[model samples]
Target: MDPLTIGILGFCALFVLLFIRMPVGTSMMLVGAVGIYMIRPQASLPVLAGEIFGEASNYSLTILPLFILMGNLAGVSGMSRDLYNAAHSWFGHLKGGLASATIVGCAGFSSLSGSSLAAALTMGRVSLPEMQRFGYDNGLATGAIAAGGTLGILIPPSAGFVVYAILTEESIGRLFMAGVVPGVLLTALFITAIWLIVRRKPEKAPQSVTAEPVSKRMASLGRAFWIIGIIVLTIGGIYTGVFSAVEAAGVGAFLALIVTVIRGAASWENIRDVSLQTLKSTGTVFLILFGAFVFKTFVGFTGIPFRLTGWVEAQGFGPTAVVITILVAYIVLGTFLEGFAILVLTVPLVQPILQSLGVDLVWFGVLIVIVLEMALISPPVGINVFVVKGIADNVPLNTIFRGIWPFWFAMLLAAVLILVFPQIALLLPNTMFG
Candidate 1:
């Protein structure tokens, strides 16, 4: 078969396997290996042959496990609970205050953990019961957690950004820096969404009587200072060129460990649990990466990316139109695929087109992650929704799905902001890198 035909067929088969519930990593690897053997066996086998071990031993990839460990350590040590308690003290007086506080907590935790599901699950445990106690509607309560959880991938130290950088050969530091402003902006947007919901339906989110004394509030805030300082030490170091991404991961993990120990939350069992969880999370991510690398190379050999880029350019749709189309497709695709899976599968086809248009890869990356953020809360295959449902099982699946729509729209608005002001995603990266 012709290379184009092989690429088309292979792509379709990969999707079919995914629909049939094949692990995305396994499906991609299978299709890639099969495509290569059928197309031209000689050149591509070496790439697939070493993908498993090569990515495993990759030095730069060390940042992933280190960052995951930091998050897991912080989680096991109750740092996440402290952060939520702090947000609650300050925001618990407003209608929907607890839900808003949950969003704030998720954002802060995202800074530390950089995993959306972790942020959601941790905050859900900490905040959900509190919100329920305050008579907050289940939909509003769960929506905030599910939506806030998406912040994990847009914030610095994001595993999604790490994967994008590795795939696009973009600088990880620049990508991390690019995420800072957008992450905060989206968090603010989520808070606004909660406020709007409660403002319109006052009974849905009752005001918490948590009007704690100023001194008490200040003390609570003080407890959160070290967490802020940790962000500065890790993400801030990357922004100022004081540390490489991998080094920043190390510094963050080490500091997280210290904080856990200092808080007297340390235990041999906690350490063991953190280590074991980190190992599991890191292994899942690495396997997908291995398979993605294999699939990307297979597609590259077929010349599909170049041909697709050439055809799009030849169509006179212009760069903006092409970009808008891709974004829309991603928004739709997210409903069916996990965020990371959509990313790995589509970038092979889309990155070349964006590059050909002279679009900045770093900015495009931020936009992609933002869209993926929406994907996490999207209907049908929204993984974070399912994650939160598992935690808040009393909430109906459709209700959980319904709850995310407002935040999903907020994320969509954030994407538009990034589009209109590309600087939202690029300013830090440019100021730092330039």
Candidate 2:
């Protein structure tokens, strides 16, 4: 069989294995190994060994574990609770204010954590009960937290973008810079959607402000300084070239640990729990990354990605049309796959096609993240929704799904903005990295 045909078969087989409930990492590694063996029997074993070793030893990949540790530390440090309190005190007086505060709090936590599940689960636990106590509609309360959690990925230090940068050989710093504008824009759009929904149906978000003195509000805000300091130091340092991506991650993790320890949040028990959770999360990410590395090698050996790009280019489609098709494919696949898996599986193949079409990689990266953001809140297997559901068990699943509709629309709008004005995504990266 031709290399292209072999590649196609391998791709299909990988997905089939995934559909059968096989582990994603194992499935990809299995397909990739077999494909490589078929393509070049003499070199397959040695190449597979080298690929595994190289992928495992990569220094850039160490950033993943550090970032995960930072997030886990922040979660255990009780930072989310302070952030939620600060947001609630400022916004809780208005209709749907608690929901708005939830979104804002999630965004803040995302800046420190850089994991959607962490942000969603942490914020949901901290804010859901408060929103419920205030008589906020269950749908709005749960849905806002779930949808807002996606900011964790779109914001900087994003694990998804880190993986993409490593796979594509793009500048991680540039990719991180590219996310800032779009992240803030999406956050604003989500807040707007909540405001509009509440305005149209005030009954859905009845407000109940506690009679707290201004002194109490100021005190609550004081507790959030650690979160603010960590974000500013991490993001600001990276953008200014004062720190490399890995250095920033390490610094952030250290600061988080110190703050947790100083505040008495990181006891022996808390440290044990955080360490174990971080290890589990880090291991899962690295395993999948190794699988993707092997799969990409197989695809390259088969020459499938090149042929597919050629075939698509020969179809007489314009650049816009081709880009549209790729985005649509991501949306469909996203319904069933996790965001990281989808990114790993498709980016190696899609990126060359995009480069050939004169598209900007940084801009495209931001756009792809927006699409992945949608997947985070979509039904069936949306991880964010599941996180929220797990935290707020009494709220029916359907209500959470129903509440996410407006945010979904808002996300679509954000995607369109990135598409129509690529500058929105590219400006910061270009200005900073040029």
Candidate 3:
């Protein structure tokens, strides 16, 4: 069979495996290995060994564990609750204020934790019951938390950007810098969506009967200063050229550990649990990354990226149209596939096309992360939705999905703005890196 035909069949087989409930990493690794052996039996084993070793020994990947540990440690230090309380103190008086507070809390936590699931889980645990007590609609409450959690991957220290950077051979720092403006923009859009929702239907999120006292609000903000300080020191250090991305991760993790200990929150049990969670998260990410590298190798052997790039050039589609097409494909695939899985599966094929179009990858990285945020709330396989549901089990799955739509559309709008004005993604990166 022609290499393109082989590539197509390999992708088909991959989907079948995924449909059968195979783990994404294992499925990709299996399909990639089998395809490589089919095409070049003599090289398959060697390729597999080399890929595994390369991934294992990769210095760049050390940042993953450090960042993951930093997040887990911060969670154990009561920072998530402090963040929520601080936001609620400031915004809880407005219509849909609790929901807005949830978004703010999520954004703050996202700056600490780069994993969307962590943000959703941590903020959902802290904010949902309070919103429920205030007579907030289940959909609005859950939706805000889920949507807010998506910011975890768009803000600095984002695992999504780290994975994208590794896959595309782009600079992780540049991708991170690229994400800052878009991340803040999305957070604002999500809060605006909440306001619009509550304005049209005030009953969805009833106003707080009494505003927080100024003294109490200031106290809440003071309590959150540790997390805010850590975020500034690390992310700010990166922008100021004081630390590489990896150095930032190490510093953040170490500082988080120290704070936990000083706060008397780092009991032996807490320490052990944090360590274990970090290990589990790191292992899962590394497994998927290893599979991604192998799968990319297989795709390279098939020459699909080149052929696809040629075909797109032949068709003469404008760059904007090509980008829109890719975004649409990502949204559709995101409904069925986990965001990282989509990243790993498609970047190999799409990278060449985008590069050929002279598309700035730093910009594309932010754009793709935004779509992935949408996917986290997209129904059927909305992982963040599921994470929220796990915590708020009384809310029906459909209601959680319903709540996410406003925020999802908010995300869609963010993506559109970024597309129309690439500078939204490029400004910080260029200014800082140049």
Candidate lDDT values, in order: 0.90, 0.87, 0.91
Candidate 2 C-alpha lDDT tens digits along 1-434 = 77778898998998899889787888988898899888888767777788788878988888888888888888888887888989888888877888888888988888877788898999988888888887889988888999989999889888878888888988888998899899989989998999999989988888678646788778888999898889899999998889998899999999999999898997889999989998998888777877888899898888767887898789877788888888989989888887887898998799879888888888888888889988888878788998888998898999999999999999989998889998888888888788
Ranking by lDDT: 3, 1, 2
Error of 3 at 100 (Å): 0.6
| Model 3 backbone overlap count | 0
Residues 1-434, candidate 3: write the lDDT tens digits: 87778889999999999888887888889999989998888988988889888988888888889988988988899977888989989999988988999999999888888999999999999999999998999999999999999999999899999999999999999988898899899999999999899989989987764887899999998999999899999999999999999999999999999989889999999999998999999899988887888889999999999999999999998888999999999999989988988999999999999999998888888999999998899989999999999999899999999989999999999999999999999998889988
Best first by TM-score, ranked? 3, 1, 2
lDDT of 1 by residue, 1-434 (tens): 89889999999999999999998899999999889877878856787878877887888889999998888877887778888989999999988899999999999998888899999999999999998887889999999999998899989889999999888989988999999999999999999999899889999998777589999889987887777788789988998788999999999999999989998878898888888989999988988999999999889989999999889888877777888899999999998889999999999889999989988889989999999998898888899999999999789999888888889889999999999899999899989988
- CA RMSD per model (angstroms): 1.2, 1.5, 1.0
Best by TM-score: 3
CA error at residue 204 for candidate 3, angstroms: 1.0
Worst window of 10 by summed lDDT in candidate 3: 204-213
Cα error of candidate 2 at position 117, Å: 0.6
